[model samples]
Target: MFLRFGFVVGQAGIIGTMAIVLFSNAITLLTTLSLSAIATNTKVEGGGAYFLISRSLGAEFGGAIGLVFFAAQALSVAMYVIGFTEALVGYLPDGTSPTLVASLTNIAVFGCVAIGAAWTMKLQFLILAAVLFALFSFYAGAWTQFDAGIFLQNTGSGFSGGESFWTVFALFFPAVTGIMAGANMSGDLRNPARSIPLGTLAAVFVTGLIYISEAILIGGCRDRETLITNNLVLSDIAVMPALIAAGVFAATISSALGSMMGAPRILQSLARDRLFRWLQPLGIGSGANSEPRRAIFVTFLISQAGILLADLNTIAPLITMAFLVTYGLLNLATFYESITKNPSYRPRFKFCHWTTSLAGAIGCGIVMLLIDWQWAFVAISLFAALHWYLSKIDLSADFGNVTSGLLFERTRKNLLKLEGELYHPKNWRPFVLALSGTGFSRPHLVVFGHWLTSRTGILTLGQVIQGELDDRHRRRISQERMLHAMIGEHGLNAFPAVVVASDYVTGVEALVQCQGLGRLRPNAVLLGCPLSVDRMKIFGGLLRNLRGLSRSAVVLRRTDEPADDWKPPSGTVDVWWRGRANGELMVLLAHLLLQNEDWRGRELRLLRVVDNEAGIDEVRNHLNGLLKAARIPGVTKVVVSKDPELAIQTTSRNAAMVFLGMQPPNIGDEEAFFYRTEKLAGGLSRVVFVQSAGGMRLES
Candidate 1:
């Protein structure tokens, strides 16, 4: 009915302007199709656009876009109020002041919205009837004037002055954006699962058909000059101009009231999502009806700010950008849901396709850029900033975002592809089997194992509970609970399992034997230092068994008390290399530990002891070669002393942790190996004794 709005800005002929409308409707149709598909698939709730987006794309994206959608809805209230005021001025006597009429009209509209939603909705139905009558009158009056020759006036001249097709297209786009009217009211609908798809698609089809028919009637009934000259062509063509004016007034006021009501609802939803701490007060509903009084008041203030502006010419582009970006992201979200191939993504609506969603997304983006490149950039930047902030906050909405499913699908495919690929040295990772009973008594063992794995490999905490087969189930459950508590409390990303065995030795054997699966078996095992002679025998036996199973082992003992160091910890890793296979494994483990953020930038020192000062340089040179071959950065220090224990203690006093190679402790002896290592670490920091078997060799 108001197709002439395009002709005032651009000199485009009737058909040229209608082309813009058709394009906009095509996007709206696509969006409607996608929205229907999603609404049918899931249980759509109050958040409307935000609910759909957050549940599909994740909270970060949903929160970010939801903020923009709220602002757009609020600003749209001002836009419609201003339009209503303009229409009011058009009907008044020629002497009437336009500014005074607009100011009073704005106040009346705000008051109507503030009174209550039920009253406004009742008024909405009355206005809708007036709009329908006006639409019918215009079509009826213009039917007699519709001549075949009128269609021949196809010259693409826009306005009497001149304007680009893109400029004209921007103005027409908002007409099609009405498809979201039904979606914004999704919260209040009783049967959103059934109502949203049916209602939204119906609106799109009806509105789309009306706009297309109106475009044709304008082109077929009027000449180019008449279309350009008459800005109020709907009134000029209507049987009764007053009825058309009534339609214009009702349409504008109803639109303004609708946005005024819907904007606050979105704000309340956002506040409930904890999008910002300050928005908490807005989430509180005041009446038995759960009215968003606080949110409504805030929206009123924002609308007043817009109303106070002299013109909406500048704000117009921003509003369009907001809608375009929202539409684009909505399409993108649907596309991800379809492409993820998740079994849960079964949409009840059969017309949905990834191709349709993709096209809609790409179309929105292209149109947004074409309309205004700088504004498009600004819109995207705002979206990105909001997304980054929400991600950092780590807000928990638990909306079953599609990111995890997408990543899982990709990971599965990549792993399958990699199965046939050749192995390489640089790709090697340490799969560690860290044995710590409950992992609580010795927390550092698990922490160090996590560091050694560098988050790129698997680290499993294996606890062996000594119990009889009769009480095995209960004991295993208890041990598993304890293990889980330790893992959670420490914030360690490691899996845990418990085995019930008759004795400690049997438990350790079971743990070592069943550590991992086919290609993911644990290549390294970590253990705590033995405290007694009986434990020493168990440790030696376990070490022998691990060696037979082709695994590397590290026996650790902390000498000094632990410190609460900062992350990417500030300390040194001293590897006391003894020129053996175990020493090689120790150096490699130290290198891997450095890969973790907790150990990043910490010092890595490789120390060796020699009998004389003359051979110290030779030892340093040899260690340097090993460091180069290992492709790890380190400082090689050669100590010229007869006593290596004194050398280790004095040199590693300030180090965070020290690593040294050792032979398995003898059960029959004084357990001197453990005692000697304890004495060596007496005045130093934490220490770990490395013992490597065949499976621990460098990957290359």
Candidate 2:
């Protein structure tokens, strides 16, 4: 406020001060132009530096910068309070005691700052407008005192007196620092690009002119120790101490208000997008839809904490120095894009291919060269460390909850239409087939696999209703439903066979249980897999049982798909008349196979497995003897397999169709079983076992 304090720098130092003023102006121009360019392309949603940087760079950079912006804004608010109180202290009349007024004013400004930190944009605009007018009056008031020749007198030489060139440079840095205060609010602007550039640049120009004007005006007042007296303006209508203090305080408050208006929204954006998880928990709203307010509060709170521990007086130069590097990075980002000719490099506001930005950085470094390096080092190092951490920690790892897996998957997905050969049918329409229901699931699976060897089916769901229930009745119904559903679903109405579950693990045992006067016997006895260890014993029992039960051969299949996509397998009937059972069943199976396609002679594998040397000799002899009478080609095999299942496995190795006798599961059991002789789930196989009594059966 005093012309005396302006004389703290000798006349010669004012010349250096003028240069400092010019440097600050340059910084403002650069800050404004850069921020404006970014603002136009992006909607200037609040979150200040955080919003602008994140959109231009990415979420990580934005998040880290948001913290810095918030910190700076909060600190400025406190600095405003202190400045206002000091001005009030200076404003008290000489005769009146100033302590009470100074103390009360300090408390008042403190409250005002707290409220301002949490204030709305409309209210802030008012404060800014009022304070701006007050600040303008200072410039107008001082304008009349300005003299061009005073500048010439002060220009003794560069770094005259005890000041070094770098010392003068350091003084200018803080003056430029205020430009960033405006830049931080670009995110809140309606048109960031245009407004950021214009507001920032204009502020710097106006502020720098005012600072220079004040220095010039004060310097010209006198060579006296104090430039202006306390009552000078009141006495002769000249400079007034009260007016000066009030004006500066108002300007400071306005600048602080701008900080509150702008910075936190950047942090809020970071929180929303998760520039970092560490930052996401901040910006909690006090009211409904108070995102901006919440962000501002958090920002102010942190900045206040920082300022309290080491207020602006202590940290101002360090902040300016840290921000110098910040500006340089921006310039470098712009430079890299411009030089690489990357499409994003094109700028709306141009200044010699990014030199304007570089100049800001170099100028910042020059000022820092003379300031407190310890503080400057700490600030710059902390910022650099933060940037490094942000880069190294993947946002996905650290802030993954902010977005969805779908987005990450899509972003990282390779350009492929299909993952693999999902399915193929030679461009044919998808085939439809069917399978029956199951008491449990094993039987239907085997049956479906058998059908799928030559056809495709759709998934079918079946449910059965029984009016009455009891343990015995329930078992009966379950079995009945299984059989009926299987028979109905696979369209086996024309066939006499039905899929059935068996009490015994043996295939022939199942056959026995399924056989009765009205009960149906399946043409195919499908075995999922050998359910018992002694499959050979089961097969032998099946052979012994087949003689009387009058069931038929079995088809065993394997598949991985669900019971859907199944249909009756394709095969040709090759019948061997081993007995009356074989003769009748061959006639029946031949009829069924022929219904689909002509039966080829090669498909007739009348296989019979003989257990021992004597049985084999007898079987070969029978084949020769029976063939002599029939004049038909019949396959006869004699294999030694102590294991009953092995015998079937060996026989199935060469024969697609194995004709053998069918056996009942047990005496009095309506459905009987046939031992499966093949595991050809992907192909077609039929095993027919003729019973001694009624007829034969063929399975695929």
Candidate 3:
């Protein structure tokens, strides 16, 4: 405050400086309230703000901001010490170097912090006394120099030296950035949720009033030229000039000490989480209170680098950007907690609302870009890189975070909205549920389902356990987890579901009837062809049941090739167009498959088998017109064959994948239908028998 007040007033004038202070303070207060809300909602421990954030936002975000916050705190030590050095140099003997003074001041702060937080608190009381006395002296003596004309002249902006309103704001924002000082000491405080809010709010309010009052008084009493050029004008206006000097030293030293005490604790908390292996040793604490001595040493080195820069204005903006980024994320965390309405997020503090937190977040971001777009970009890039790096590291936490809750809430709302919308063929997308029993045993079924959906729609890998729900509930959960792990291992975008019933067929029926939410439920079911006669009968029965439920069925008949040697085929996808009943779904599924990277650039062929050659030209013209109208690229072929099934197998024998139309078996003719399907797909590489429920259209 002592160092930058003149710069802000000189650049933006009195009214602009007051506006900056009020705007910054209001946003800072909102962010503080957000912090208080989160802190009170849970049991906050060591790591202060980092603890609250990591536990709320999850590890990646928390760890990223913790590192940034730690750097800000370390740089803050240099900024404050430099302020103290600036005041001290004015009173020192001629030729005294400010760099040497700043280095010595940093060493002094390090020694005080190393002793422990207890001693630092004791020193803070004496420093506070000096600051208050200095304020009293300035106000008491400024009345004699106050003039109406000078006050009016300083009220409007009189910017000079290439300094705009935002430039001045960048220099002054650090004044209000100390709101998190209390939150950073969360580990050392008793009942932190209570003390942090009460103390931080009070400090912001009181200090904000003091800054506004000082700006008003200084503007009225000091001339524009003097205020613009003089960094130590406060001392000139004070009745006891020496007391003002004492206040500058006291205030700056107190701030440096606070940062010195806070930075190491944040680092220690970050290390204790063991997110990064290199930082593990810093987590080791010594003495009765377990002081972060190693972290302190690291902070000291970083501060020395900041001190080497030596200019307060240059260092101030860097600190401003870091603090703003941290503050914005804090508000965002709180806003998500509130918006998601997670039951566990019940905070004792009620004054804060989601809008306030959102505004605070947005306000911080706008200020960041307004100050310096280039530096803001760099700071944001660094933050994103850290978050990405931390996300890649496998750090598990026992406690729950809000990310899942947020996703659930959003999904719920969208599902409800979808339930109200009208369904149309133009918007049709496959929501496939693949009943692949232990996907590892029938990998072809899972792979086929993935190719059909491939991120354009939803895929759920479903498993059926033939047992009573009471006996298989735990096993069902375990199976579901296994399926989820399988999806992750194979890098497939899908969900997992498991159902238990009294019989295999009954379990499959249950999964078909209930597996999704609202209108987002599965529209198609995929199954692997049975290898045994008994299983083939069951598959025929399932196909009939699916037809009655108005659901499409895709049955995959894999070759005798081993699953481990199976790879996505690079040849053409052949679709045998028998009729519109299953032809549209076959064509659409082929299109979707081609959208995937593995199937990209592969050929698609639409082949039709007719009994005579007389209608071949007419059939070719019809297929070409359909392809042009649908905007789907494919080759058309017309064949005259008395046995259509034989022609299909012979033509697509070397195809990557073949799509064929099928009809559900009559109740008593299941065995006959199974044999026919087995013969039709006899020598094909991989065959998909699609039975569409007539709910989709490719040309729409």
Off-target runs (Cα >4 Å) in candidate 1 are: 1-18, 93-100, 155-160, 409-700
Ten contiguous residues minimizing lDDT sum, candidate 1: 418-427
Query: The CA-based lDDT of model 3 is what?
Result: 0.84
Descending-TM-score candidate ranking: 3, 1, 2
For model 3, the stretches where C-alpha displacement exceeds 4 angstroms are 309-313, 409-700
- TM-scores, all candidates, are 0.59, 0.49, 0.60
Give candidate 1's error at residue 260 in angstroms.
Answer: 0.9
Of 1 and 3, the candidate ranking higher by lDDT:
3
lDDT of 1 by residue, 353-456 (tens): 99999999999999888888999999899999999998788475644666654543246555453443333232345778888675455666777787776445
In the range 568-671, model 3's lDDT, one tens digit per residue, is 76579999887788998998888788767777888989999999999999999988876654557789999889998799888988888899999988877777
Clashes, model 2 = 50
Better of 1 and 3 by TM-score: 3
